[model samples]
Target: MWQRGAVTDSAPLDVDLALLGGGGAASLVLAALDRHGVRGLRIAVVDPVRRRGQDRTWAFWGHPGSDLDPLLSASWQRVEVATPARRRVLELAPLRYAMLRSGPVYDRAAEAERRLGAIRIGAPAAAVHDDGDRVVVRTGGDGPTVRADWVLDSRPRPPARPGRTTWLQHFRGWWLESDRPVFDPDRAVLMDFRTPQPRRGVSFGYVLPVSDRYALVEYTEFGPELLTDAGYDAALTGYRDLLGLPGDGLRVREVENGVIPMTDAPFPARPTPRVVRLGTAGGATRPSTGFTFSAMYRQADQVARALAAGRAPVPAPAYPRRHRWMDAVALRALDRGSVGGPEFFDRLFDRNPPERVLRFLDGTTSPAEEVAVMNSTRLRPMIAATAGDAAHRVRDRLRPTRPAPAIPAAVVATPTPPPGTGNRST
Candidate 1:
């Protein structure tokens, strides 16, 4: 528990790097720094809240040999996907779908921090400024202005409004334990699109069962607006009824809820010379699938490598240009109603081998494998999204460009972010 303190600015504490927000991304960096045994560098991670519990769950399909793989809670060899008219079960050979709870991973990072000696502050960063040689970050409530050689801001981006070229993968889930054995402990439902669809968006349900009687089930939407609490409750009720998990016999244990930005809006990893955006804000989340863990892990390695080499870090993207291009295309199609989620997903799964599709989604496919996956998609959405992208590029080329107005030093002010400013689900 944290308490409000007197707004007194303290003396400067110097460090090699300061992580603005201590969440999964910061933890990954701490773990990496520890693994590399990088010495003579001080580090600190500051966040207002203690990021405890299973705040979120991340699922991905991979070969599972990373340092974090040992923290995996559950994995499945076979996964199922359903549409209104079709059901498909994919057997993932060489790669399996896996889940990791945040608790153990958080604990592991805590252990790693013993080496780096990074402090996690319980306050929001008010503002960050690149002061030529170093970046100065001021926290709210007159908290000590943390100065470091570099800053990585993992704060969630602002909310989306009308007129943005973005979609949201919003979800609400319940962890349930049933009196009767009602779940397949060995399998996971990738997506069940039998749920009632919104007027203009796609919706689905997922089930990850840990036991015959325990599972985390949720309804998700890739749409314009997030579902209300009541709406999510109704969807969950329908899913339970469909699965024949009775109301009286089922006990809801806990709930998880979040919204992830699905966009191609230019998210430059570095917003300032001394500060680099990390995690989802830095474009780690896959725009199409809303996955982030694997991408963030790759990014951590990139940043750690640059620091070890004693070079100014210009972290490479976790995705290739082609991967980003395809992501933009898919998002555009979904936004334009040219793509229906159930059918779009079904086509990819039904036409391509599961490994190939997973590889494509993971952004690890070769050019040839990419071509094969593109061949499986509906051509109309591809054409539409491609045309839109081309038009935007041409418009930019033809239009006049101007430099951004500079902020005068006399009038500069950095406001404290409201609590949980950059908060987003992984």
Candidate 2:
């Protein structure tokens, strides 16, 4: 391994891991390293801006005894889903629909930095190159460089998006506090598809209540592009009107908005094995649902175990090949409007237990259970979608892979992928 030149001391400094970007994926990797008791290894987290605020909320259905147990800000044991004509309620016993604020996560991450003793270089890295045994990271212009035995390139994203199929899960949410008790604090609305949908995509509203008077009201859609500022406001207004939420002496406390990519582009690209790509960059994000939190955690733990075994971390495919193939079938069908999102999801929840459906969406379903879920969907449409998917894959394979142009150091970062959802959506 290449070592840094001596400056203040005689011993050389060589980082065991150089995190290309210090977002959630990189943070989780450090936590995994600490969990596995891999100490005395130099580590560096490179990013320009420190994660700030509780501006984003990450919601997931998790066990009460899991790693996120202590970090939960709010949770609901009973969940509800609705369409214009039908509604269903589900009871989650050991698993609860939970939420964690970004504020607490960032605070705990600070503690990780202190405990793990990682070097935080608050600068943007322009390029990451794998040099056989070591990966050299260079900053723009005259900035310093660091070489590490292994590099996990989790930089926000490549400059050019090359997805033959890309759908965005875009949403805007308002945190509301009411003077009177208006929401059921014990229950959360996973999806209310009673609102008007777009001409091309499905739309829904989700509510997560913190208390009887406080809840998060979100308007979401799976569409081709992100809505305009005014477009989002109009949609939120319409949904608020549909639910009569703006009245009843209610006030908006805080607001947040974000867009998540639901693409069948193999989640960007797979580069070298030595310089492995991380999280969504490595196709960890499920294309059909745009969920990555659970997958990222699993992948980080896997990488740590591989390294602890005195071997290079070769992260297995986050989703099995069959799952990826199935997702591609769904993506093409949805993008072409051959399938309706609401109808498909309603059937999925209606046919299988929510827990089973959730496991399937999380990519943890057994082969038999997966078969049952697939049986619930209309097979003819899937067959058609699969044919198109095959053609797209062929074209994508034929296309040449070009290296990304150099990113100027002045550019800080790209849009960060939003947090995972609590719903068992497909």
Candidate 3:
């Protein structure tokens, strides 16, 4: 193993793996690799925000006795889905909804890294390039260069087309506590469409009750809306009014907010030779669901196994070309105003078995299950978009024979607002 704090002025420190981005993907991969007895592999995690105290929660559906169950701090047995036309409560037998808070996850990962003594922290990688044989990662702030046999990049990708169209699904949630039991703590309100739908997209509210008196109430949108603090306050008020909950009497405990990109950009799975992409950067996230934590866990496990066996880390076969095509079709359908935003999902839940549909969303369903999902949707426009995207992809792949244009490193460092923001209705 390389000695800690040892760096030669002109030497690249050789390592097994270097992970970029310290979000859900990086943490999950590190944890899985540690579990598999992959020791003495020089691993370094690079992220601008290394210290974690962020208020974010990830929720996913898992069967009983899943490996993630032990890590969940809170969960729900029942989930509710609602639209203006209908409302349904799914019992979710054999499957439970689970949640993990970011703070605890960071603490656990940091402790594990310290115990293993195989990983390095606080090194924010600036650029990664594949130098024919190995992947070289340049770090910021005079940090030593790390040359790893394999590199996994988990950075979020900007939208493929500038000003094409984008929307941010962002929300702020207030943890409310009431003197008396005000919520059904055992159930999670998945989606309530009582809020007004935007002309260009859709909007809804979600509620997750953690206890008899405490709950997370969130307002979400799938279209453009960069909400100010006052806008979020108004949304909370509107949600309370629609739910018939006492707004004036409720006690506020804590608040959490986040924004997730909803796009159809094809994030490359393999960016360079010997370098693999993980997490959202690798299309692990379902475009329709914005759920990536569980997917990242599964992807990380596959990657760790491959590394242990001396194989290049390719994403699992479950995420085939068909899945990418489906996402592209759906995104185009939404973008072109071919389908009503809420109606599309409403029809999905109303027509298909909830479990099968959820499985498809999780990228765990079989081919037959995927067929069933396709049959449930209106097919003409979706199919057209799929064919068009396929043709475009093929043409682009065949025509790409030119050298990459020179791009200054400073150009990539500029922070811009994520896509989908411009199309949102005020």
Candidate 4:
């Protein structure tokens, strides 16, 4: 059983939880809390954009019958990894590669909130203050300030340095219908690093086929390169040419473009007392992988359990400081140019078992497994750099009396193994 109430000027709108952000992360947390039987908590989701629209796609590896199975809009049993040197066709054994489009997820979440009752929406928060005993959230409209015992902020952080090493992981996909069937709809082209490598960073082409005649082709990168309309035209031309496909045979449909952070700067976790951060703002996304939905869900579960037990939402069991450190190490490697982008991933996949790799990305691998994974990358340079960086970071932490060095402006921004490469068929 849960309790629900509205805040009045006299009562000051005190609720159990106040969530900022209406994106996937916030929704997942709300859903998890609801499922944990933490009911009647006056919840408010604040976001500037409330309408659901197609944004980006989320892909993750999961067991066949996982809890997230129902949320998947599409999935593939077979995935292909291609590099200039070699190609590997893997069957996702015991696990499947799943994708959930953003629109449906947002719609589902909105409906869920309505049914659950006491969950408010479309309230744009102006600012939040920690008053020690309670957190006060000031909003834009006439709505009264929301005071909560706990608050979860999931707002996307602004890039630490603007225009420095800016890269849009953007892509244009033609949901094409071919005159004649060309693609193996059952198989997904995970990475085609066969394209020309960018000198400043790394780039690759990917294709996700939904049917024999329909698929999405996209080009992605890790450094500053904004393609113009003409540039996209030329690149798509080159992609089709390289794939030995006739562009005239396919009919174009929809397109998508997205920019993701690729920096190593530490995202702030402590904002104010009784008000915690969630989603990417909370460092839920792996700085290297830009994957956070699963991590957010896991964190939500922990928070819900804590609330259900009548405990302070302080120690979320899912995200440990150690996991954040590992993400920082990987991001540092990229920022320092210590490893080539493609080769870094190639070595990772080649050395680690798919399951172990998945576990590491999910932030759940044990200490022994973590050691094994570190050795598998054969990233000696990265290993050495990480050790040195770790020592320096620790020393700085201990010597807080010393002035903290300013973090480089450009060094902030930015998981997962697809299952079944060990045994399943494509």
RMSD, each candidate, Å? 6.9, 5.9, 6.0, 7.6
lDDT of 4 by residue, 34-97 (tens): 6777766667665666646555567677678865667776688777777889987777666667
Query: Can you give the lDDT of residue 182 in candidate 1?
Result: 87
What lDDT does model 3 reach? 0.69
Clashes within 3 Å, all models in order? 2, 0, 4, 10
Flag the better candidate by TM-score, 2 or 4. Answer: 2
Write the residue-wise lDDT of candidate 1 on 1-426 in tens digits. 222211233655566788877788877887887787766776767678666657667788888576767888788989999988987888998898988877777787777776666665567898888976999888876467778998887777542222125677788777788888989988899999998888877899999998899988888888768777678788888987876677777776767777776766555688778888878877787878878878888888888888888976557887898898888788888878887888888999998999999988988899999888888889977898889977866675676653322111101011222333422222
Colliding residue pairs in candidate 1: 155-422, 156-422
Q: What's the lDDT of the predicted structure labeled candidate 1? A: 0.76
Give the Å shift of residue 164 in candidate 4.
13
Expressed as tens digits, the lDDT of each residue in 1-426 for candidate 2 is 322211222222468887777666777787777777776777777677677556467777766787767777788878998898798998877667887776666666666766777776666788777768888877654445877888887765643435666677788877778888888889999888887878887899989999988988889988786677678778878887887764657766667676676766544334754687777776667778877777877878888888777777667778888887888788888778888888888888898988888778888888999999988887888789999888877876788865443221111112233332211111
Q: What ranges in model 3 sit over 4 Å off?
A: 1-12, 159-166, 380-426
lDDT of 2 at 215: 88
Highest lDDT model number = 1
TM-score, predicted candidate 2 vs. hidden true structure: 0.87
Candidate structures ordered by TM-score, highest first? 1, 2, 3, 4
Cα deviation of 405 in candidate 2 (Å)?
13
